[model samples]
Target chain A: MDPTEREVACFEAGIKFGTLYHQFAGTPVSPESAASLERAMEAAVENQPHCTAVDVAILVDELDTTHDYTELTGRYMEVHMRIDYGETVVRTEMRMEDGYPMMRVVDVHEE
Target chain B: MDPTEREVACFEAGIKFGTLYHQFAGTPVSPESAASLERAMEAAVENQPHCTAVDVAILVDELDTTHDYTELTGRYMEVHMRIDYGETVVRTEMRMEDGYPMMRVVDVHEE
Candidate 1:
């Protein structure tokens, strides 16, 4: 069966977010890290027809005060992302698992 | 922030699917069981604005020839559902967790 527009948007967003997470796998949340993620996301979805615009936000876990990048391992991230595909928007909460991003669909809707 | 259209659709679909699963908590898959789930789903989203129509399909695990509904406790189900909300469609895979449905958003998209 054909996937719905919402499904396509969510799937594409998942791929972009996965790439973004990989870019910061072993690094802590810093300004430069955020910029690199944004650039990676832009590049990943640039040629996609449905995804017109994309925005991603990475918020470090407040409990991670030590900036102990090495200690914050496993699938335990507090990062959230928002992707805009003009007609549809997708929001996701993701966690890192073995250096890969595993996302949960927080929301998806039309503009 | 206001949730996007896709998010709202996925959230509502989650609720409906959750209710549908609860209605068949300890029952094995049978024609009667399927009918009961369908009826429950229809009632759950009957008045929702965006969800003009909804359809669900439950495929029992092929290995579940024993029909051991009780043995299939825990979060180990092979049930999948498809929910259509005119402009959007949501597909979910669910497992029973302590007799309640725990769904994973397999896909969601616009029509």
Candidate 2:
């Protein structure tokens, strides 16, 4: 699909990067788009000079039968962003952990 | 893609029904599979008699450039299940609010 359609899919899928933990419950992404996602991650790193060497992993798990709920799942992304506050050239790794649905900013700390 | 390919895609995407939020960041899902997902939701409901009408909405949002992170995104799925503890017929709507890459169960309770 084209970018516009893809955007619509995203919109329909209701995936907001900020609130991704609440979206997709559990299912694998298609290959066609997966390639673009990897590229997007790379771009996310390249675009942000303050951020560098970002690593990400998507995780999914099945829910126990006891809860009558579908499988429980989420995603995880880690990044190394450069922090420069005017004069401070601080290099730190920012990890976007425990993402749900697509991805989310779980915790950002110096690593 | 066939079921196997689709499953593989999900696997590569690292999507587990238990933890889907950490995978996809900000981008729409392709259409071919979206239909299957909707079907899956329905099946999830049919399979679980304890669960009734499972209303789900996929939400994706763009993140501001304050921290230089990608757009904020996620998905949301709501479900209503019947509670029959041998005799108790409880009808409740379980909102699987905010699905991420594909989907993830964030919160479940009286809703």
Q: Largest DockQ belongs to which candidate?
A: 2
User: Which residue runs does candidate 1 get wrong by more than 4 Å?
Assistant: A28-77, A95-102, B1-111
Give candidate 2's whole-model lDDT: 0.35
lDDT of 2 at B106: 35
Tens digits of per-residue lDDT, candidate 2, A15-108, equal 2232222233233344333444445554554454333334434321222333233322333333333333233334333333433232323323
The estimated TM-scores of all candidates read 0.33, 0.26
Which runs in model 2 stand beyond 4 Å of their true positions?
A1-76, A79-111, B1-32, B52-75, B94-111
What tens-digit string does per-residue lDDT give for candidate 1 at A7-108? 555645554443444433455444335556546645654444344555544443432555433322224344555666557777766565566544567767
The fraction of correct interface contacts reproduced by each prediction comes to 0.04, 0.00
Instruction: Per model, state how many residue pairs clash.
Output: 17, 82
Among the numbered candidates, top TM-score falls to 1
Q: After superposition, how far is residue B68 of candidate 2 from its true place, in Å?
A: 21
lDDT of each: 0.51, 0.35
